[model samples]
Structures are given as C-alpha cells and as structure tokens.
Target: MLTQHTSTCGKSTGTSTGARPGRPSCSLTQRHLQRGWFSRTPLHCPHRILSSSQAGCRLCSGKKRQYSASVRASSAAGAADLPAPRENLGDRIGAFRNAFWKFLRPHTIRGTILGSCAVTARVLLECSEYIDWGLAPRAALGVLALLCGNGYIVGINQIYDVDIDTINKPFLPVAAGELRPALAWVLVVGLAAGGLALTAANFGRTITLLYSLGLFLGTVYSVPPFRLKRFAVAAFLIIATVRGFLLNFGVFTAVRAALGAPFVWSPAIIFITCFVTVFATVIAITKDLPDMEGDLKYKIDTFATRLGTKNLARLGTALLVANYVGAVVTALRMPHAFRVPLMVGAHAVLALNIILETRRLESQQHSQLAIRQYYQAIWRLFYIEYCLLPFL
Candidate 1:
C-alpha cells in the first residue's frame, strides 16, 4: 500500500501531488490565510485554464474554441484573398491528403512506428530453431503497450502545461488551441483503453499483469493528483529505469520464447539495460535544462532545478561518457563470439557525438536548443540496436 502511494508523494518530502496543477501546491486561500474562513469565495482562475482538478470551465473551453475558429478562419481568409478560390480549394485538399497519409498526430504516429519497429525486430531476432512463432501475441502486446503509454504521457503534458506550453511551445496542439485540454484527456483515456484491450486480447495473466502495471504507472505519472512533473527527478527515474529496462526485458522475453532459446536473465542484458537507462536519463536531463523556468514556476524539481543547467548538461555528458566506458568493459568481458564489432562501432559513434557536444558546452557557445537536439542527429543507440538484432 505504501509502495503504491509513495509512487507520487515522495517518501521523504510527502509533498501533495494533486494540490493543484503542474507544480501542485497550497490553494490560493491556503497560500494567504492558514485558517478561519474570512468571507470565503471561489477562487477565479485569471488564465481561465481551469486545471484538470477543478470543475472545468465550460465558458472558458467554449471561448477558447471560438477564438481558435476565428483565428483559423481569419488565416484562411487571408490566404484565400491572396490566392484564387479554385487554387485554394485544391491546396486544402492536398494538405489534408498529405496529413492523413503521414498520420499527423505526432506522439501517436511516433509511438506506433517505434512500437512496430521494436516488436518486429524482436520477433525476427528470435526466429531460431528453438523458438516458437507462438510469441507473436506477446510481441504485439508490447507494441500496443508502448503506444498507449506514449499517448498518456503526451496527454498529461498538454493538459498541465497549457499555460507554460502556450508561452514556450505555442506549436503544441493543446496549448495552440488546436485541441481543448479536457477533450485531450478524454482522448488519453480512450487511447489507453484501446491499447490495453489490444495488449490483453490473447495474453496470459503474466503479460496482462506486466502491461497493467506499466499502463497504470505511466498514466498515474501524468494525471492531476499525481502530476509527476512536479517531481521531475522521480519522473526521470520511472521513465529511465522502469519503462526503459522493462521494455527491453519484455522484448527479450518475447524473443526468447519465439526462438525457443534459453531465457536466463544474462549479465549482458543487465549491462545493456543499465546503459539504456542511463542514456535515457541523459536525454531527460538535457530536456529539463531548457524547461527549468517552466518547471520552477510550477515547482518541478528537475535536474536543472536540482543542479544548474550547464552543470546538468555537463553531468549528463559525463554519464554518457561513463556509459560508453562501461559498455566497452562489458563487451570485453563477453565471449569473443558474442562480442560484435558492430556494437563497438555504434558505441564509438555515440560517444564521439557526446564528446563533441560536451566540448561545445564547455566552450559556452551552443544554444540550449542545440544541446537538446543535436545529439539526436547521431542516434547511435538505435543504430546499435539494428546491429544487436542481427546478432540476437
């Protein structure tokens, strides 16, 4: 019971996770007056954000949608005036066609693609004479689980960051008024349900239990009462450790089942899991650096808040470097036949990218955005996965 409860409220801090939205804190009255009702009145939300914890403001929702429609209409009118009606119609049709084909939902599409790739890779890797084709259902569940999990996280992000996101990332769908935050929450529930159903369609109790835990924890981390964003380090640990390590474990299990291979939880897997988890933490730290201000206002205790921005990035780079060293040491300890040159090459590329980025950081020249995304260009970890799959 304590384990389930402490997942949100820190064991040390016991900070309320659902007190408000975002950073979650004392109420308006509580902030000003500790006790005694002094003409108590409903606190009016100036931004009209109506945090998910509150009884939602229908008027605010309607006004926001109305304002959005007007802006869209005005923008359309301006474009229409510039172009001929026939041309504009043709352009609109083309844009819609492109969007539909590309599957314009960023998080949804990315989740689906990555999930599909990971599962497909696992299945192919386990095609040895010993493994069975029976593991298909399990592999498929992993895909659904990842997708559902992604949507829940994105939904939570949009719902809480409506104010900050509007300022920092206006392009975000909810903050930009392309979608209402409350409606987005509905979509989150629907997606999560669909994902769970898909995962459980033919799975056994073991797989079902795993998926349930993953879905529950991921969703809980996003919802209002928990709002794990306030505890960014905790959020990082969950995503980096549980999500990353368990994802690989699930994939490895499915692969072992399919290959009919011995399924011991090998040290190699442990090494890989630690490397992957640390790498994710590094990415999380980099992301939190630029988001420090938004996090600070909301009382989110991210790496940047705990450590300074430059220090956090530097620390992340150091961890990345350490990860490479550990990977090399682990690889050397492995049987020569299992030691793939491809793995070493992939690690080298990633390490070099980290090193260059770190040097740039030390020089104090690169912008925060560059630090956030530049390393993605290398994407060495994924390339390493491609090599590892062939070996598996």
Candidate 2:
C-alpha cells in the first residue's frame, strides 16, 4: 500500500505502508519541488520504480534547449548574410548616371562628338587665314547643343519604343523599368528646348534653323501620328537627311560663319556629305537586323523584316564597301595639295576589314551577337572617317 503525504516544500511524497526490505520510499526534495520535477506524477519521482521517466524528461528538456540555441544562432547568421536594407545615396546616383548614359545612346553620342569636332577642325584647316581664337567657345557650344539634340532624339525614341525595346533590347533603362516614362519625357523635352534655345541665342540663324529642322525630323521619326520609322523608305530618308546631310552641312556652315568666311561647297565637304549619306542608309537598314523578332511581332515593317536578315546584311555590306571604295577613288583624284596617303590607306583597310567581318558574320549564321558586333564595327568605321576627314 502507498500513502501520500505533504512535504515541507509543499509537494506530495509517496510512502510504502507495507515496506519491503531494501526498498526506499519515494521522497520529494526541495530541489525537485523547486525545479517542478515532481509536478507530473508520483511515477516520475527519481526514487520511484518509474524513475526512468524523470531521466527521459531531463533528456527531452536538454534537447529542447539545444534546439532553441541552434535556432537563435541560425537566425542571427541568416540576418548577417542578408543584403543591406537600402542602397547608399552615392550608389543610387552612380546607377542613375549609368542608366542616363545608356538612355542617351552612347553610339550616337560618339558620332555627334566626332562629327562636331571634325567639322570644326576641317573648317579651321580650310580657312587657316581667318582662324580666330574666339571661335573655340562657339565650337564648344555647338558640340553641347548637338549633344542635347542627340539626347532628345534618342530619349524620345526610347520612350515611344518601350514595348519594342522590352523585346528587342531588354537592357535599355526605359525598357527595363529602371527609368520612368514620365521622367524620360521630361528629360527629352528639356533637352529639345535647351538645344533650340542655345542654338538660337548664340549661333546664326542658319544654324538655329538647321537645328530646328533636325529636331523636327527627330520628333516625327518616333512620336505618334508621325512615326516615320514605321516606313522603311521614310525611315531611311530621315536618318540619312538628318545624320549625314544636315549634320555635316550645318556644322560646316556654322564653323565657316564663326570664322567670318563665306560658306563654300568644298570638295572635301561634298565628298563627306555624299559618303555619310550612303553610310547612314546602311545604318538605318542594319540597325534593325537583330530586332527582326520584335519588329515583326509589332508589325514595324523594317528592311530586316521585309527583306530578311541575310538579304539586309548583304545589302548593308555591299553599300558600305562601295562607299569605302568610292572614298578611296575620290581621295586619289583630289588635287595634290588635298590628297593624303592617310585617307586612301585608311579607307582601303576599312573596306577590307568590313568585307572580312561581313563574311565572318555570314559564317556565324548571322547570330544576334554577331550582327550587333558587325553594326558596332561599322560605327567604328564611321568614327574613323571623321578622324581622317581633316586630312582629306
């Protein structure tokens, strides 16, 4: 028989009334009571026959404590591994700068810079007798105005072509959602306004008028109700007229006016105008090569889609090769004083390089990456021509 009695610690104790030899009664200790070791049942008391239950409870409690500690450690480690909650101001500013640079279309910007500098240099060379140091500031301002115009043109295109770009150029800032459309519109509008204002205030009426016309064409090229880019012939004409004819002729006239010299259709300027016009046509066609998928999906009806990438590639290559060859022949025929070995040699080399690149592109099956590389190589050739124009 067993009887329960209250211990000094206010816990129950089990005593064996029919005590057996060598058997001890189950007693509650102050420590056990304080630890709540006897709170479960008398069978869990350490001195009872079911003492193993107490040991099992202790083991379970120890395991739970270890598991809790491990969970806390893991939580702390996970928090340490996480990225910072917010980017710093400098990081944000740097990212925006990169995106804005892309938004400006670096390739076109390069062409503008080289074309402006080349025109100014060529004008100075042709009219060295009328060279004035004051024209330097005007030339710098001209470049700035052209850059603004370039930005506006490209930015507006990006804004309107977001869906097309998302498919064709997912990396573009506007297409990728890095830049908001409203912000893009504000930037383009500001650029257009600033460019026109700068040209009108500082340059002659000729330059201002030319600048306005270029802006107008650029606007109609991409903006709704006049998106001329939808038509192959219109797009080609616009690109050539704006980039090749207007840019070169307008810059030449501006520089000549700044030098107090009357504008003349110099052999060099005429040759460059014709050469670049053809080159711009090539650019207009080839630029759509890699974008055929998106252009087709959107019914943009570009040359690359209508004629196919292979056909367009061959056409662009043939046009560029012919332009280079014509440049070489033209350079050879110039007056002794106008002839330069650099012009002839450079064009010859560029023609060969372009031919080889086109062949390689065909060999590669005209992959998107190869097509882009070919296009970039053509731009490099464009830049080279500007660099060598002074020699001509």
Candidate lDDT scores, in order, read: 0.57, 0.81
Off by over 4 Å in 1: 1-127, 130-142, 255-262, 266-268, 362-366, 375-389
The lDDT of model 2 is: 0.81
Lowest summed lDDT window (length 10), candidate 2: 1-10
Q: Over the stretch 243-295, how does candidate 1's per-residue lDDT look in tens digits?
A: 45666665566556545567666555555567667866766666666666677
Task: State, as a TM-score between 0 and 1, how close model 2 is to the true structure.
Answer: 0.80
Model 2 lDDT tens row, 1-392: 01112111122223333344444333433334434333334434334334323332222334334433433444455555556689889999998899999999999999999998887788888899999996688778889999999999999999999999999999999999888999898899999999999899888787899999999999999999999999999999999999999999999888888888987888888888999999999999889988999999999979998898888888998999899888878867875645757777788899999999999899999898999998899899899889988877
For model 1, the run of ten residues with the poorest summed lDDT: 30-39
